[model samples]
Target: MVTGGAGFIGANLVRALGEVPQVSEVVIVDDLSTGLLDNLDGLPARLFQGSVLDPDLLDDALAGAASVVHLGALGSVPRSIDQPLQSHHANATGTLMVLEAARRHGVRQVILSSSSSVYGANPVLPRQEGLRPVPVSPYAVSKLAAEAYAVAYSACYGLPVLPFRFFNVFGPRQAAHHAYAAVLPRFVTAALAGEPLRVHGDGRQTRDFTFVGSVTSVIVDAIVRRVTTTDVVNLAFGARISLLDLIAELEDILSRPLPVVHEPPRPGDVRDSQADCSRLRELFPSVRPVALRSGLEQTVSWMSGHVLTGH
Candidate 1:
């Protein structure tokens, strides 16, 4: 079972699971808040339409499930800044409710998606899970609380939970129409529309952007192998790219130069982020992440057909 299965990563994972021989059934629970039903259209996964905070719905969803991947969170640093309470309730509290339900159901594995943003204000180069998190924003605090709850559940009740600190994950189906859309998707959409790509702060801020396919492959492999770890895992390879570099690659893929617009840096934003993936590599040795350029090309193709830019 997957929570937030109607969203970008969740939908991709659901599609990937359809191909596996070991998987007999796939179930997803999501409230259609940000996750569009269109994302799951024609997919072979069963849907339970509700929020993870709904304990009754969670009770129903967790029944007879082999495992649950928790990805249903209110994501956005700036939004969380404005609505910290809502973010906390939906992310931190919602995760607690899911963990409780999974525990009651005796689920085999509880794989939770946390964020690298939890490492906020730490000023650590190449974030490791062991480094103490110094969260600056309310969103980071909420995610930290969520992951901490997962880890605590693992220790206290012996729940098999693997918490993942994901870097900037991007690929097809990632939404870019919103004001808080991810950098890659936003850049792609603007470029497609012949609009200047908005660069937050300088174009020098770096991130380790993992493709969604690589992430899904790891999750599918974990389910197949019944992999469980008490430790938090970093979910991106070590390659770091600045925003300017990302634009350069996008320009190469499109075979055209794109204009740029500089914007003031938003509050509670990190300077840089990269994941130290030694632990992830040790866990899933067979997976190779899609190159950023390849992933960007795929994303551009997907977006041109899907999203109507400058409409």
Candidate 2:
């Protein structure tokens, strides 16, 4: 069973999973909170309309599934800042419901789509799986709490679950204007529209932007192999790109000039972050992630051809 299977990453995973010969049944449950209906267009899966917080609905979804991939959550840092209580309930409480349901159903494997924001304010380079968490925002706090639950449940109940701490993931189908949209999509939309490309704090803040394809591959491999890594694995490209450089690359990709809109750094914002994915290497030995430039080019092309043209 896949929760939030209609969002950017989730939708992509559904498409990928459909191509697997061994997979005959795929069940998708989503509330459509931030996910788009268009993402589910070609998917061949049993669809259920419900929130992860609904225990009755969750129980129904978890029943009879061999495993569960929990990707549903409130996904924006700024949105969390604006509405802390709502974000907490959706991400933290929602995750607990999924884990509990999976445990009760005797599911073999669970893969959580965690975040890199959990390394907040640590001033750390290439965040490792073993580092002490210092989440900066309510969103990050919620993810960290969910990770704890996944780990505790693993140790206490022996439920095999793997958590992937993703870093700056971006690709097609990402909502550009949603309250919690990732920064890359928003910037691409602004750039394509020839509007002011907003930059917070001099645009020097760096991030390890992992491609969505690579992220999905890692998750699928983890699930297929029933990966036994106890610690939350870092899913990233192991390279950092500054926001200024990112904008430049986007402008180059778009073949246009980008205007600038400077703003004060928002609260709960981290200075810099990258992922140390050696642990992911150990878990999935054959999975080599793609580079940022190539990934960005592919994403920008898709957005321009599809989203921008409205075709």
Candidate 3:
């Protein structure tokens, strides 16, 4: 079962999981709060239009399920700043609901979608799982709290859970329509429309932008192999690039030179973040996710034809 299956990360994961022949059936649970219906178009998964907060629906979905992927959450740092209570309820409490449901249904494993924002403002390069999670934003706090809950559940109840800490993941299905969309698709859309790409702060902030395909691979591995180690693994490219440089690269891809408009950094935004995925290697020896440029090229090509053509 996949919660927030219609969301950006969740939707891409649904497609990837469906293509896996080993998997028989995939169930999707989403409230459609931030996720769009179009993201789930043409998917073979059983789509249940419900929130994770609904115990009854989750109960039904978890029944006979071998594993569960909890990806549903309010996924915006700035939005979380605006509405801390709502973000806490959705990311923290909602995750608890999924954990409880998985526990009750006798599911063997669950892989949670965690965030890099848990690193906070520490000057640490390549954030590792061992670092103390000093989250700055309410969103980060909620995600960190959820991570703790996942660990606590595993230690206390023996529920097999793995929390994947994903860095700036971007790809084809990412929604640019949302106010709090990720940078890649949003920048792509602006460039395609001949508008100035907006850069927050000085735009020198670096991020390890892992592709969705890479994230999906890690997710599938966690479910299939059940390689439990630190209970948290960084799913990232381990490569960092500044936002300004990333924008320039995207502009070059589009064959159009665009002006970059600088804006004040939004509150609850992190300065820089990279990941140390060495532990993941030790656990899943066969796991290797796609590189950044290859993934970006594919994403740009797909978005140019699909979203730009207005088809």
Candidate 4:
């Protein structure tokens, strides 16, 4: 069962899981809050439209499921800053509900979709799981709390759990026009439309952008291999790219200069973020992240088509 399966990463994961030979069926549960039903179009999966907070829905969805991929959450820092209570309910409380449901149903494994935001402002060069988490925003705090819950559940109930601390993830199907849209998608969408690419602060903020396909690959590996250990690993390319440099690369890909609009840095925004993916490599030796330039090219191609189709 893939919670939030209609979402960006979740939707891509659904597609990837369909290709696994051992997988027989994929059940998707989503509230469609930020997730679109169109994202799951033509995908072979059973769709259950509901929130993870609903106990009945969770119980029904987890029935006979061997593993559960919990990705349903209120996932934006700025949005969480504005609506902390909602963020807490969805991210923190929602995770607890998922854990409880999985435990009751005897689910073997639970894969949690955590974030890099949990390492907020920790000045650490490459964020490692061992580093103390100092969450800046409500969103980060919620994800950190959820990770703690996963750990506690694993230790207490003997339910195997794997929490992945993902950095900036971008690729096809990532919504661009939304208020809390990711940086890369928004930049690519505006650039394709010949509009100014908005840069918060001086655009020097660096991030480790991992492609969605690479993320889905690790997820599938975890489910297929039934990884029993309860561990949190960072999933990223282990490379940092400044926002300014990212724009320059985008301009190169588009073969045109993109106008820039500077805005004040939003609260709870991290300055620099990179990952130490050594643990991920140790667990999944075959994992290889897509290159930034190459991933950007693929993203631009997809965004260009979307723009052309007025989607």
Which number leads on lDDT? 4
RMSD (Cα, Å) of candidate 2?
1.3
RMSD of 3: 1.4
Collision pairs in model 1 = none
RMSD of 1: 1.3
lDDT per model vs. reference:
0.91, 0.86, 0.86, 0.92
Q: Sort by lDDT, best first: what order?
A: 4, 1, 3, 2
Off by over 4 Å in 4: 307-310
Worst 10 residues of 2 by lDDT: 302-311
| Higher-ranked by TM-score: 2 or 4 | 4
RMSD to truth, every model: 1.3, 1.3, 1.4, 0.9
TM agreement with the true structure for every prediction: 0.98, 0.97, 0.96, 0.98
Candidates sorted by TM-score, descending order? 4, 1, 2, 3
What is candidate 4's TM-score against the reference?
0.98
Badly placed stretches (over 4 Å) of model 3 are 309-311
User: Which residue pairs show collisions in model 2?
Assistant: none
- Candidate 2: lDDT of 195? 85
Model 2: per-residue lDDT, tens digit, 193-278? 77898888899999889889998888777767778656988888688989999999987877777998989988988899988878
lDDT string, candidate 3, 156-271, tens digits: 88898888888999998787766888888888888877889888899999999988888888787777676554368888858899998898788677777888999999887889
Task: TM-score for candidate 2, please give it.
Answer: 0.97
| Model 4 lDDT per residue over 81-177, tens place | 9999999999999999999999999999999989999999899989988898989999999999998899999999998899988899999999888
Off by over 4 Å in 1: 309-311
Which of the two, 1 or 4, has more TM-score? 4
